[model samples]
Target: MLVQGETTFEDCLVSLNVLCDVLLTVAKLMYPLPEFVLIHKDESVLKDIESLENFRLNVYKVTLSQDCELYDVELHTEPNYPTLGKKFGVKSIAEKIRQMTDTDIEKLLSKGESESPLIIIDDVPIESEGVHFFFRVVKQTQFEAIAKQGCVVLLDYTADAALKDEGRIQEITSRIQKLRKEAFFYVNY
Candidate 1:
């Protein structure tokens, strides 16, 4: 497990980038691995394309898989990417107040202190925004995505539901081969 180089110990444990790359290449040659591994942001409620794309790009930087067919720089933004908007802060008010009616502004301002729980900063209610990242491992035609955050390298292994059936099939095939080898049929008969 020791990599002889100037790499840090933390990099050795968390990253092991070069080793993982080599092992993944070898694994592909040694066994039937997935053809594609997709790293994507988790389920998003944002409707903004710019924001979503930016977040996905950030995720691509932290992802650790390489040499897979699913590795694409633009895959994160392929289907859709949401935009960014000011939610409930001064920015929201400044930007949206012009589009809102007088009644709408009044209603927002006249809400009771106990009306709803709000996170306020500088006396302005600011909406919270967050995005989760997920990994999708695809083998042949099957694929499933699992949500996670930060880095999503090893976490994809246990979350690959698409590979479970293949694993069982491989196991059964191996067992049947073993049984066939054990059985001596009429070869010369």
Candidate 2:
């Protein structure tokens, strides 16, 4: 999780090396010879990967586009309207997601790479219809869906206030572990 520093890029690279060593040690203990380790590093951490571990680690750098925005069309849906207006069309949401995903696909394609399982992590609030609509669109696009992958995971830090009930953390952790076994990875931020 090291990022660009206030001074220079070299400092950031040094920080990333330190972080990667720590992460590699932890990963080795967690999984039995993990074939592919996807490190969500930005441009700053790219050069530092080689210096971190002796063994090869399959790294995927995440680059978020500045132009795209998550538009909540539900806000525009007027009250007393039967169902909703065409302005909140599922097709629009699907198109936006397609464009966003296409950017990443194009980058991979340029490097002569093929498609892999994708896991998206977001921290936004989830509403009922919104969740259903999103999953529907994702399925139509042929992307496998998971809750925390498609939405957000309630973190341990919010355990006391947000999820105060006893055994809540344990419950969430179990579910996350189940998902890890089935899906690409857990998006526990």
Candidate 3:
């Protein structure tokens, strides 16, 4: 099959920003909660509140559904706007991506890299040359579920040392849970 229009390194960055925002939003839901803003009522009028607005996250995936022939492939990034807007006092994923220089993207996309944020273009597996361009979601990004009007969590094993060995952690947790069950402590998943 013939491939058309080059997929630049910058395109990868845009995609990553979208993905990271989704992941972080999931993190907020499952693990740590976002800061609770206690709106003061004495001066003017306000109530204590955390964000109650619904957030939308859209991920564009490469597909071969319509046509067989290769066509002009442009990176479409309109969906990531809202997530970028909810910045945590730090640069939003989108803005951080915007701030990156071309050289920075080049380096980030280069081969022989020992780092997090593994970049994969299309559904292809890791190659020796590293982050080359193609288009499609990787296996890792495959969505098993989408929670509407509710919270969801995505676990990150690498973030903590204890979490690195997930099987061991799960086993230990299971054992503790069994002991709890024997002790009349019943918690549900």
Q: Compared to the true structure, candidate 2 yields what TM-score?
A: 0.19
Candidate 3 lDDT tens digits, 46-84: 211122223321111211122111222111121134432
Give every collision pair in model 2.
none
RMSD of each predicted structure: 19.5, 22.4, 26.8
Q: RMSD to the native, candidate 1?
A: 19.5
Global Cα lDDT for candidate 3: 0.35
TM-score of each: 0.20, 0.19, 0.16
> How does candidate 2 score on lDDT?
0.33
Off by over 4 Å in 3: 1-93, 111-114, 117-189
True-vs-predicted CA distance for residue 76, candidate 1, Å: 12
Selected candidate, larger lDDT, 1 vs 3: 1
Against the reference, the lDDT scores of all candidates come to 0.38, 0.33, 0.35
Query: lDDT score, residue 177, model 2?
Result: 87
